[model samples]
Target: MSVLIETTAGNITLDLFVESQPLPCFNFLKLCKLNYYFFTPFHTIDKDFSVHCGNPNYPNPPNIISSSIIEDTQFQDQSLSPYLLAPKSTIKPTLGTFSFVKSIHENQQVFDSRFIITLSDSFDDSLENQVIPFGQIIEGFTVLETINNTPIESIELKRPLRDIRITYIHILHDPFPDPNNFHPYPLEPSEFQLSTMRFPELSKTTKDINSDNNNEYNALTLELVGDLPHYSIKPSPETLFVAKLNPITTSESLEIVFGRFGNVKNVNIILEPKTKKSLCYGFVEYNEQHEAESAYRKLSKGCVIDGRKLHIDFSQSVR
Candidate 1:
């Protein structure tokens, strides 16, 4: 069966694998029939990665019936246990795939109500056992792109600066039979450890090169490799790929230099996984692509900071 979701961005249609995910499919269908997804915001949007919604907590239009209430009243006979056993086959969370998020506590896995639709490719192995893919987008990819490209106000939480809400959901066809006696299966604890890394501290002063002796500066260039792992759907003109950074360079120092061009959305210095120290390279995302392009061009022409000549270019990677 197919489902049509009407959102503030646009309509997105999904093709469900009812046979593969009967429990989740029927559960989602039942909720849609009751208008359970109305006014729900896409709270987590990872540009070029995914758009996640279905949080019962942060619904639009202020107050509405909570999922918990619905579970207690209308779904009294239905099993609302969050952890259901999924298929053994590993599903790659590629572009346009749909999956449900799982939360772990005290070595038990429970499903969250959130639904995630991939906007681009992802190969995170940690997601293999945690997310259960049950569907794929059949239409409205451009709308997905629009949502993925939305300017992010917060990087850590992945919240969009503007709101994107699910106005309604229309089930075109539902073929799965409800499993009223469904029970959640127990799961082993996941091995993946969540990262607790934070950006490095910024330098207090950025030393600028004297205009009269600019030629004395030797540019330190790091060879560009394949695009960065995370990026937006389209190449952001307002984002810069910075390289050859001093290992000690702080996100604060980059913000000061780039903020001169325009409002800096985020300054990220890629860090070593184990040490959590600077990788001597980073990215700066701006509110406007033009601002990022401007910073890249101007800085590439040989800008010196803290006695180090920097190499800058337009970032081609998407997060």
Candidate 2:
């Protein structure tokens, strides 16, 4: 079976190994037919490494074509069925090779919804038993490279500067006749909820800011404290410290405000852990240092956010 992924970066065609990896290939094909990949962002882009996607929680939910895919069967049983053949004993993950991401539970590893495509020649012996390489990209290597080279806001998390979203997935071919026969149990509620997650629309001001702020920021912060011979690292200049947020301000609002400066890598709102209430402060990271500086200067000059003047500065914490 084969599928064509139309992403903001470009189109990539993947050939599935249905004979060798029936369960994963079948599930992937089914998801494609149901338009499960629409608008899903490629959350991780590690240059010279790999680009990761299929995350249901990064920006928003998958565009589910049918609730049946979510209600039909449990992913764990289908993925780990004894009837299914084991993955190849060894995998040489070259560029364009596709594989599933695994989640660790105690000593056991379970399949996660996320998947990755290698961007370089590399292999992981430990992943041979855990991750299943069900497909290989047959086209659009350049698109993958473009995604890998996209500016990033966080090197540690490998988040893209701007969301490279999957526009849609078109199933070109599928040989499976009785894919439903492989079902085991009903999908868990949490899994279904995750597949249907949604987020509010970004504000116009935020959109305008992201469009205008295009310069890349790459400055590193070095701190030298008195009596200390070694210099300590501070947060990247691309990261902004935000304070005096309205108590009722939401993470979405914070994102819209700071996101104007540049592509927001991440936004963290300090909260009362137990109550999950906003503590009226947060941090926002941009892809470039100039973006953060612009936000700091503009917002510090006293921008009213939800009726409160926001305090912005460079964060002291290291990235």
Candidate 3:
């Protein structure tokens, strides 16, 4: 059996070892035919190691083609007879082979949709027992290399700097029969929901400004690092540029106005050289990045003080 995985990075074709690894191959092929992998990001990528995907929660619920694959249902339980397979010696894992990420519980190996594509030849030797290599990349090694070269997040978070997603899976040949009473979706899902142009933020919700904004700040931090890892560290004590301020707006008033959002580190109003009079602009620094972001989102739209409209944004000038 063979399948073609079309990703944002490129296309990769894999030949499945159906005879040697029937269970893994069967599960993989069935999921592909049903479009179970649609619009799922390659959440973890390491250039030196292998790229991992098949995050159960990564796929948008609407994009899941088959309702048969329910939440929290691992591949082992979906089969005809509930069974789990260990790594097979029949297919010695080599570079560009597909492998299931083994999860051991009670000293028994369990299979799931999550899988990895080998990048380095030494990968198999390192994870021989932990992963099951069920298929080999027959074509598109260039695409595989492209993904391997892509930049990733920190070692703690292996997310790719740019989202490399599986847009579609094309099953070329399948020797295995479908499971009993199984009805796969007839057509591929529309990309309207999961547009490749922009990586959609999942499950964002509005919350009280008084609530802890750590989660909100983390989400913004991830978005900012998408194109480049320019910032050496998370922007702490984030500064905001306040323009169109009332000529007489004092630093104390600015602090009072913005302090409601979060802790006010300091406020500096630009002043004339000799007069020390306000220049109608200033910078407000927040002790936390989320505070500045919250204040910006709330006050940037329309903030009026001392009978003048205030314009707010993150200060471009490095402090």
lDDT of 1 by residue, 94-181 (tens): 8888887666535765444567888888647776887878788855676787788887768987877666666556565677444454
Clashing pairs in 3: none
Q: Lowest lDDT 10-mer window, candidate 3? A: 62-71
Model 1: per-residue Cα lDDT at residue 248: 79
- lDDT tens readout by residue for model 3, 64-83: 22222322244324454422
The lDDT for every candidate, in the order shown, is: 0.61, 0.61, 0.65
**Using lDDT as the measure, which candidate wins?**
3
lDDT of 3 at 158: 75
Better of 1 and 3 by lDDT: 3
Which wins on TM-score, candidate 1 or candidate 3? 3
